[model samples]
Target: MDLHLKGKNAVILGGTRGIGRAIAETLAGEGANVAVCARNAGQVAETVEALQSRGVKSTGASVDITDADALKSWIRKAGVELGGIDILVSNAGAMAQGNTPEAWTQNFQLDVLGAVNAFNAAEPFLDKAAKSHGDAAFVIIASVSAAQADRADSYGPVKASLIHFAKGLARENAAKRLRVNVVSPGMVYFEGGIWHMIETNQPEFFKQANSRNPTGRCATPQEIANAAVFLASPASSYTTGVNLIVDGAVSNRVNF
Candidate 1:
């Protein structure tokens, strides 16, 4: 598919590795200039280089997505550097699971507020892009856990909040041609990712978890990235205020 993404500019938060890295590479492959930000400077640099190698402009910065001010600055700088921000992907999460207050704070600040801040900081550029190109997008990388919870933890609830937030943004920004959507992935596995660590440290438990999925395995980062990029592309201009689940039948809960 063409995706009509040529020359478009995108910025992704936490785009150095895993799903985020896949999204960046996929966008660049489709001829979109991409800017990425993450806390690890080395990873950010490497990702940017890889994206650029695909023949699209790419740049990155070491940034703490939890710090509102620093995140805003990097995004705006990236927006200018990339010429404009047509797509903003909030792919960062604290990934701190548990019933502790610290976990709640981490998830709330990074997962929820990270998306909020990125949208706010990039709104002007997105609006400008929409005005010129007739469409713009903000895609949030949520998780299928938002719809199911096995225990009381901050991860699922925090992810659920993102779906709510994106829906509201879609409605409010419709007139401006700024599309907002969410992609919920389940059990995505990549090297150095949460699932990979578990797979290495606890083989039996990992096998049990993977067996629960109808596919008898987990999703790859590229699989999640594909859906995310599609949502962000102008090809899906009519898609908004929707949460697309890419869980590969792993989640049995009937989406109501």
Candidate 2:
């Protein structure tokens, strides 16, 4: 309940909107300092201001996560500015679909490399925080699509790679008290997100998508964020190298 997160600092990628923004706000509300980064300078600024309004020290930067050097630099700077990164959330994704080479490139660069660079840059800060507090975490936002795919696409494979990466990190960093985990969301919908656009332009497909969910609906950004923030919190100290699926049972694959 308490989460014991007060005074901790967190760095979030793509925290300007959607599920990323919700995670930032949730951490801020839990009394954790937050730093977010995204390509939109205006949105980054707005999110920073909004997080600070929640009475937590907050900062943000405009960053293109596809650029490994730039993403790593921002993450390092954010770790310092936040006073040490106790939690790192990789919530950014290209969301590129299809089997085209370009789609694969985009997903690999943004979704895959983005998490790799962020973790590499934040490892030192994360190790330091864990050494001092006995708990530090990296939460990767993946998708249930990673577990099952109906067709060839870049999105699912890239997300699946992240799970593998996080598991390796978790095992290697366990001695450092740095826990790594994944929160895989299914069909999360938010205004201006992909689902919203689909609802507007491809009404029948959107309706069919909703109907596919056993709950007869999709998840909210906040719903996914709740799982992410929980994993990032000290309360889940023993929950490393695990993928928590928050899909309202939309996904049929059993974890067994």
Check candidate 2 and list the clashing pairs. none
**Residues forming the 10-long window of minimal summed lDDT in candidate 2:** 73-82
lDDT per residue for candidate 1 within 157-243, as digits (tens), equals 999999999999999999989999999999989999999999999999999999988999999999999999999999999999999
TM-score of 1: 0.99
By summed lDDT, the worst window of 10 consecutive residues in model 1 runs over 247-256
Q: How accurate locally is residue 124 in candidate 1, as Cα lDDT from 0 to 100?
A: 98
Candidate maximizing lDDT: 1
lDDT of each: 0.95, 0.94
